[model samples]
Target: MSGIYIHIPFCKQACHYCDFHFSTSMKKKEEMVLAIAKEIQMRKSEFKNEIVETIYFGGGTPSVLTSAEINFLIAEVYKYYSVSDNPEITLEANPDDLSSERIIELSKSKINRLSIGIQSFFEDDLQLMNRAHNSAEARKCLEVATQYFDNISLDLIYGIPDSSQNGEQAQQMSNEKWKQNIETALSFGIPHISSYALTVEPKTALNKLIQTGKIAAPKDDVAQEHFAILIEMLEANDFIHYELSNFGKENYFSKNNSAYWLGKKYIGIGPSAHSYDGVSRSWNVSNNALYLKSIQEGKIPNEIEILSVMDRYNEYVMTGLRTIWGVSLDKIESEFGSGYLEYLNNQSRKFLDDDLLFIENGILKPTKKGKFLTDGIASDLFILN
Candidate 1:
């Protein structure tokens, strides 16, 4: 089974910490949607051998579009692709855009899942991130959304400047408030949550603010503490810490993301979207105007990279180490031959001895201590060719 990812590269406003490709303008929104649908139809042969089990509307902010526009795109996928009878279609939304009427409308559509960008329930944190939604709207939208959609995932951001940091005292989100944010989200009874630490990427508003001393940078130690709190609270509440950043209750794990982590093929449509077919990876241009122009000319504006043996192996190790499934030693041996298997075994010795990693039933997984540093551990296991 495979998946289709459609990127809606438009946002109502830019979040201070965001570095994703998106425009705050809706001038080209209609043209972009049409291009995305055309690109989906054009790339049908890419996944001709596979049945689509998931269709993900990732973004900019998918909620910016009307329900009719979303359904139109879904219809295009149905027309050109062999979709599973019960495909999981998810839409990424921001709280401000998900009004009561919008939620009701979305529920009637084919979209079954909602990934709300709640970020935080605290007003100060929301302002710090420059999120379009206020604290009231954040809670209000979820209250309304959960009633209409059961398979919902709320995104939360931790690691903002706290009282200890030298930022605007009014904007500081204390540890106690952070815990309250977690508790508030739990009170919603949502099935899935995708939490992430506040990161400052270069060229982002947050980065420039920090550089100009207008805002304090996010502290790594603080983020680690927040992450610990998240895991402890979620696990205590019966949520499975399935992946590093994702937690789901039982079978509610995101199929679209899970398919990617499991190395299933998926086609990404729209500007700045990335795709993979077992051996090669491709990404569309990030420029909206250029993407539309190329697609209008019946050409897909993208770059492709053919994966080498080492590239594929490194990716497997990287993605596998971050999830509950872990990396399979037998698959490594069968797929990459004995030489790579031996290399992995030798490279994993130090981490295994340090109790950071463990092997159970031929699956190598990161221990709780190693989960926070899975990327570093995965890098150590990479085979440099």
Candidate 2:
């Protein structure tokens, strides 16, 4: 099935470690919203006759938009696209923007799911991350959101070197606190979670702080420890470890992201968003004003890239290995030809023998050890030609 992704490129504030395209100054909010609605009508031919099972409102923080605005956007999609009967409409919200009343209002709209950005449950960690929410707000928002939607997902960040708790808590690194957060979410019977390790991108405020010795760099060991904990904890809670950084209860997986991993097609609107067809991918310009102006002129500001055989092969390997389903050798052989499949099998032999990967019924799957070096392994398996 197909999907639709709408990127809202605005945030209340920029996080120290963020490199996403967004503007704190919301001068173009109205213009951008109108542009997005127009874009849906403009791109109707892109997904003609394709039943859309997922609609994701990802962003600089989708919660910043009013319910009325959100409803208008949904109406536009319905007016143009052939959406499924029960499409999963998700909004990415920060904790501070969510309230019990706000969530109730959101529930009345077409939004069926919520992906809350609760980076951490501790005030100190929030301060370090420069998140717009406090610890109390993070906890309270989840409780309130649960009352409105059972299909809720939480996002958490771990492995920040600045995170610490003294005395009894000092015995554990900051990552351990994430376990408590997970348990709290489980208590609420939340359906999904996306956990990631803290990463300092170049040119970000976080990188500058580390460069100036105002903050410590992320530790590899700490990240590994947290990753291990995350996998074990989610598994114990009977959550499906669907993707590398995502877990979901049965039948609650993100259909939008799942479509991406499975190589299904989708259309993306708004700045800094990417779209995929069967054989090619494209991305919109990252500049907000540029995106608005172009769309307003009845043009989609995007660059397209037709995938070379090698590019498609490499992407298949990379995305497949990150999910629990793994890569199917037969599909690879059929799609890329037997020569490419043989090359992958030969390269995977070493990993298979070393117990880093296992093959079952023509499917190549990674072991726990292999998961840590997934990207490297995928790179090696790629056919450069």
Query: TM-score for all predictions?
Result: 0.97, 0.96
Q: Cα lDDT of model 2 overall? A: 0.87
TM-score of decoy 2:
0.96
Give Cα-based local distance difference scores for all models. 0.92, 0.87
| Top candidate by TM-score | 1
212-257: candidate 1 lDDT, tens digit per residue = 8778778778888888888999999999999989999998999999
Instruction: Give the number of the best model, judged by lDDT.
Output: 1
Predicted candidate 1: what Cα RMSD to the true structure? 1.6
Measured by TM-score, how close is model 1 to the native structure?
0.97
**Model 2, position 342: C-alpha lDDT score:** 86
Question: Alpha-carbon error at 333 in model 2, in Å?
Answer: 1.0
